[model samples]
Target: DTAVSQTPKYLVTQMGNDKSIKCEQNLGHDTMYWYKQDSKKFLKIMFSYNNKELIINETVPNRFSPKSPDKAHLNLHINSLELGDSAVYFCASSQVAGGLADTQYFGPGTRLTVL
Candidate 1:
């Protein structure tokens, strides 16, 4: 079974459109993270949540929002998409021990293309 999964593996939308990506994890982890890989393949953390509580909010733009309905699910919504938003988004979950995150299981990334 896949530990972490994401819906709409591929998303193509216009520059001004909005879209969302759903993510779920069966690993029973307490912490989850969202990362964005730019065209250059530089992966950067966008957000992190622990026990359904927002923990880390990176320097990402306000157009990107991450919502965790529960510890097992996290979703990302992008509004007013732009060409610069074209990239791969990944969802990951990990256990927290000693105030640090343990091994993380990543989902099959969702590729976003903005025309």
Candidate 2:
């Protein structure tokens, strides 16, 4: 009965390799987001999708792609992974209720390591 879940919580690979992280939410939310937490513990939003439609997309590199198969699922794909791409990727979901945005529920996070 987890609210959010991610597969392969830990990914270890070499540079230039391609990888993808899958996320799913069971909260029946309408919006999902992809965030990255750098080594310095700075959290930044990369992409957001509302009802499977692209919304907020930060100034991230083209190698990073966010896809929402549906309102409850969001996935991230990284191409030619670089050392800079090594970070903790987080998946979050939120919904508006009574004209107010609810607290975002985050997954445990997927730690991607590039050698």
Candidate 3:
């Protein structure tokens, strides 16, 4: 079965439009997150939620928002799309790991392009 899934694996849009991508996971884990991968392939966390709680990534732009309706899903919405927003967006999740090691499994990613 698929662990993490996202829709619109490829998104092409014009600048100044609003777009949203959906994500879901079946791992039954307590935490879920959104990450953005820049053109340089650097991955950064955008938002995280565990059991319906929000944890923000300090470096994320205000234009990006995350929402989780329940433990199994987390979605990202973007507003006023810009060329700078053209990047890969991935949704992932993991356990708190406590003091142990935790590896976040990522989705195939939604490749968004803004012109």
Tens-place lDDT per residue, model 3, 31-107, is 88888899999988788787767878888888999878887888899999999999999998787721125878789
Spell out the clash pairs found in candidate 3. Answer: none
Query: How close to the true structure is residue 42 of candidate 1, measured as C-alpha lDDT?
Result: 99
lDDT of each: 0.88, 0.86, 0.86
Model 2 lDDT tens row, 16-36? 999999999999988788889
Sort the candidates on lDDT, descending order. Answer: 1, 3, 2
Worst 10 residues of 1 by lDDT: 96-105
TM-score of structure candidate 3: 0.92
Prediction 3 global C-alpha lDDT: 0.86
lDDT for model 1 comes to: 0.88
Error of 1 at 16 (Å): 1.1
**lDDT, candidate 1, at 18:** 86
**Candidate 2 — what's its lDDT?**
0.86
